[model samples]
Target: MAEDFDLVKIMESGLEGAEYNKAKFPGLVYRIQNPKAAFLIFTSGKVVCTGSKSVENAHKAIITLANTLKDIGFDKIDLDPEVHVQNIVATADLKTNLNLNTIVMALGMENVEYEPEVFPGLVYRIDAPKLVVLIFSSGKLVIAGGKIPEDCEEGLRIISTEFDNLGLLS
Candidate 1:
């Protein structure tokens, strides 16, 4: 997290597509169109970048922002800043229909939350990878909260293994 940023100067720099409304939100929303990422820049110099599918893309986005800040006369801006991956989202397909009721019973009530009336997907919390996997009846899955791509892969493997062992996969 970068610290001690001059948010006011950044806002005054006439950054194209930069939205800063202190009354609406505390942070400035800077949209980087090239890498296709939105950065939530705070007065404290802390930036939260989202919409990046990979770490490389996130890093590139930050670099682009840093360059823009430098070009706008922002002092002490780090050109090569350290980028941290806080979360990763991934999707997968089981290639077969799944029964939410049976999955809930098999995975246990504590780990599974299936409410078709409210949502069609079953929310499965995996403790090992520390991620949440959304299992759908259409055999599609969405894994989120992973710090790395490997975490998503591991979470998928664990869930697939568990489902396979229980004969849940068709």
Candidate 2:
């Protein structure tokens, strides 16, 4: 449910902490420090907020932004709008270096992509939680494409268990 927003009005208002450069980016960038989040406000009234450490923090930041907008004369701003989380990213360590070759073989070729020339890390996809995990030789793993925190945790558990069952973890 997006509406047409007056980008020129917002920019001409000379707001304290908002930057808009249409030639560079079509959205107005508004940032807040408390939750360490940045939002991209589009003329279509769609706001893309990122960099919040947790879902709660993201909600807080959005509410704050909505309030600020209302105060700044955007009366159309909804104080209790429906929020949708795109994805959640999480990281972990295996405590031991992984052999990409072994992982590729054990995990199967379909859900795993490890091309050393193209990418240094192996891309492992999980179906249950619908996540993509990046496995590196240094034992560091980055899990992404999760809808919620629990999805991330579940994906990690699935991966760790797979490696553990195969005697891959030391």
Best-matching candidate per TM-score: 2
Segments of candidate 2 deviating more than 4 angstroms: none
| Candidate that scores best on lDDT | 1
Candidate 2 lands at a TM-score of 0.92
With a 3 Å backbone cut-off (N, CA, C), the pairs that clash in candidate 2 are none
Model 1 per-residue lDDT tens digits across residues 67-93: 998889876789998788899999999
Measured by TM-score, how close is model 1 to the native structure?
0.91
Score candidate 2 by lDDT. 0.88
TM-scores of all candidate predictions against the true structure: 0.91, 0.92
Cα misplacement distance, residue 15 of candidate 2 (Å):
3.1
* lDDT of every predicted structure (CA atoms): 0.90, 0.88
Q: Model 1 RMSD to the real structure? A: 1.6
